[model samples]
Target chain A: MTAETQVREPLTLKRVGRFVADNPLIPLVVLLLLLVGVLEFMRPGIVNERWIGNTIKFAIPLAMLAACQTMTMLTGGIDLSAAVAATISAFVMATQVPIVGVPLAICIGLLPAILMGLVNGFGVAVCRVHPLIMTLGTGLIATGCLQVYQRFVIASGSVVPDGLAWLGTGRTWGLPNSLLLFVPMAVLIIWAQRRTGFGRLLYALGSNETASRISGVRPWQVFLALYALSGLIAGVTGLLYVGLIKAPSLSLVNPLLLPSVAAAVIGGTSIFGGRGGYGGTILGALILTVLGTLLTLLQMPEGARRILFGLIILTVTTIYIRLTEQSR
Target chain B: MSRLITKHGWTAGLLSILVLLFILTRMIQPEFGASGLDSLSRATLPFAFATAAMAVVVIAGGIDLSVASMMAVAGVTAAVLMDGAGDGMTVVAVIVVLLIGLAMGAINGALIVLTRVPDIVVTLAMLYVWEGVALLILNAPGGAATPWLRQLIVGPFLVPWLPKSFVFLVVCVALIWVPLKRSKLGLSIYAIGSDELAAYRSGVAVGRTRIAAYAVCGLFAALGGLTLTLSTGNGEPIPGPYLMASVSAVVLGGVVLGGGKGAILGPIIAVIILRLVRMDLTLMSVDPNVTTIVEGTIMVVVVMFGGVIAYRGRQK
Candidate 1:
């Protein structure tokens, strides 16, 4: 009986280690739980159902935006213009709602984003321009166009459509209504990453562009489609965010740009490309949202808060990198 | 002449473009003369220095997203230290501010080396850290620059037509950049940037060279900050639109983004050209908002052109 007991204990320990090594998401989930525990301990009863719902509501838009980063980072590129595209879509949609009906306005609003994405794709894939510079240039152009457009539409009042507001802020069965849109989107992305030919193509191109080209991958077509899809996602994110905020401004989604990149990076996506998934990115979004709440509860000044935020991101990323490297 | 052009074709072409733009600008604003040049030089110095800072790092195969934030920190620090100080004290303050800039850059290098983090991630994090420090030092933008320092930096030199700022720029290029470019360390920088593995195999100190490159970048960024304070006569905790502008300038000046193949003179010229274009837009009474569109368009076009040239070269 004693020999059997010792053997069983070692087997259980080995199984746990193997489980952790196989699932990278396990550590992130544990970290998330730990953070929530700390938050609950600090302020009793703050982690209620309503608070959970609110956090999920805010995290949805971020996760949507981070989707752009995840997909682009998969191809070893980044879309700096995602925030700009989102802003343009939301601003255009809101203003056009007054002049035009909701359905038409939404279509018209999404046009600019898709067009910008096409241009980015052309520059990166055809012209062989670096993704960073291409996106940066396009972003600045989009911002300028938005400003010019703003001047023309200043006289027309803007309003959020009722349907969007419901989708953005409504709830059902203790879950955010955003989940209605987010769940399908997240499922599509995860499925595409794993099961689709295009998904495998993205990974192949990111991991080794030259080899992919040699294998007749037709990279230009892939890049063009990829960027356009990214733009669409960004536009949708903007619509969701505007509805959530209930106000649309020229710089509506600008601040989310860096955070979205951070989310992707924290999700264990390599900036160098070809490694990561959207599931990790969703978790990353939730973690950042919770961390932000914790910082706000600290009641620090803006300067101190920023400093602490930067330091924490740096430390967390460093530690996470070390752990993953060792496990591998 | 053909040999010279072959050797300095980019410089020659850029100079011609500069001259053409200068003529166009002079035509639009008839008042653009020597004094106009003086003001232009003053306005260009801060950005020129900023572009130089970015150029140095890019040439070394690293990008510093924190340069603008570094400028802000240096500007506010100098403003806080030099406010209401005597000439002697202001001189000391200037030196100290420059040193602080150097130190900030060195720390960025050290952190990247020690942490084994990518340059972009480390610098991106430091960007916020330095910006927060700037805000902490001066919550609002209201510090004054010493009159003597301001005059020395922004005012004209011995000749009325020759702005002190222009002279300072020339002196910096000749003293700092040229010497470094000629030195063993500078060669090592280029070697490592072009191929780090090969450079390391050939006995180059990659880490130290990179650290030195960042340190130089920081010094120039501080100079830019100082120029900003002198011209504005106040300290600004917030960074201006220098980051994108400097990056564009560096790229426009023909520096390769992936590093190892560019000159400092190119970015300096690019900055001037960009500044000239902005002035031209203002003179033509175009909407200020449209200026950004034009700038973006120009950047895209130039990069596309460069890409085409490189593609053709590769095919050959």
Candidate 2:
């Protein structure tokens, strides 16, 4: 009986591997290419240098945020608080920018985001609280702090120094600075996930936390470090969000939470944890950006747009899970 | 006392806040003395019922974030069916509303079991879908909540002074709370959440138990929604979305996430305490947003602190 089972397992694995190899990124990449083709074809002048630059530019942060979120999720847990954490840090940093100087403010601004991430990590890793509840708890607290900050301090007519906002809005060779920063970060993350001990440990932990522990990996430390990375990435995104939008609105952070998860999941990262790459997340982000752009161009109502958004997320995720399952 | 505190965290916390709110209101508002308590009792009845419904699922270890949406859908369904059918059809409407809630629960449970999607994701997705479907039905709120609809929930019972909704809430607790604790279904729910495979190996029907839990969550959420429509006499898309926090309230009442240890009474007291806290803040001249901050912070601190306390107790 055991020999028969063993004989069948490899054959199943080979078929799964062949299926993935043939179809990976085909649907997502095809859709993205098709959108680009249609837009460029229909409005060659409008999809010109400036438009192309901006499209890629906005795609940068969306991609980076998705990538950062994917790293944490790779460990069989999610950081729902990422968007809010970014917002709080951004508001804090932006508020302090004029008073303390942009450089100093950036360092200080990064603190709150990192600290909250650590608290989140401690609750989940050390205390054994479920990640969803732990993060959800802190997410609300951070969001409340952002509200208080907005109402009392930031809304007290504080202005982020003109030069600082320029980092978000300014162009380097007609490309956004935020987008420029997103590039190196993405490359570094991809390398780390593929090669580094810490990176591999995250996947191992996510794949099976108990087995990883038994293999002598420190699960808590991995969780803490991963959360810190999540915090750092969110801090960067927060700064960029403020720079692009000019004013700090609570809604800016509120909506990003689900999309980031969707981006991660759609990018082929398993919501069940482990076995995914950031390449897929970049495509997912691009898909979302294109969808948003299309909806706006199409003049869809808010309700219809929301319905489409929810449906697409649900559909794509279900398909991804099914495909991955069959491959296994 | 420690045993009492642990078992009744929501209750003890709630009563203490109510007492504090009472004293403060008397010292300042003065007119808010006895009448204030009566107003509060009636005003908080629906939320208590909603929270009780929320607890049923929390005990079983799943989330029904779509409950508020389901409630809105069911309320609109009830109102539209009985609209101008008048006072005579109130009993029938109530029964139909309940049946609709049960049906919504059943569908949600079946989908979760079949798809194997995470409950949070499935329910979160359904939140929008159901609300969208509800909007498609009415697209506006115009129906009167009918006098009979109001009386069924709001009218006096044995005490003559007590709200019928409060009585209904208590009756639900009595019917569900004790038997659930003793039943095979309830115990198996805890087992499933604690560890799915072990429960299955132990001969518990994990899938059915979990599906039932989700179904029950949907039903409770529907009840809460219907009660809300009766209380307010309106059904708007806006209220349904904001009610997601009701689930959060249940968690604050000592229902651990990832499920297994909680009581209906815990959530019952939690909703009441939370309402009292908001009311107390209004008296104190704090902005209403302060309530959101306080509630959010309390949920985090209490749950975290609860873990620490439970850990300490185990060590002892």
* lDDT of every model, 2 decimals: 0.88, 0.72
Local error of candidate 2 at A318, Å?
1.9
- Chain B alone, TM-score of each model? 0.97, 0.87
- lDDT by residue for model 1 over B1-316, one digit each (tens)? 8998876787778889999999998889887877777888989998999999999889988889889999999999889988888889898989999999999899888877776666877787788788888898888997889987777766678877788889988887667799999999999888877888898999998899999999999999999998899889888998888988998889989999888998899899989998888878988999988999999989988998898789889999
Q: Give Cα distance to truth, residue A63, candidate 1, Å.
A: 1.6
Q: lDDT at B233 for candidate 2?
A: 82
- TM-scores of all candidate predictions against the true structure: 0.95, 0.83
Per-residue alpha-carbon lDDT of model 2 for A73-123, expressed as tens digits? 788788877887788877887777667777888888889889888988887
lDDT of 2 by residue, B134-225 (tens): 66655788555676667766556666556566677777667765787688888897887777788889999877897777766666766776
- Residue pairs with colliding backbones in model 1 are none
The docking quality of candidate 1, as DockQ, is 0.65
In angstroms, give how far residue A34 of model 1 lies from its true place.
2.4
Give the TM-score of candidate 1 (chain A): 0.94
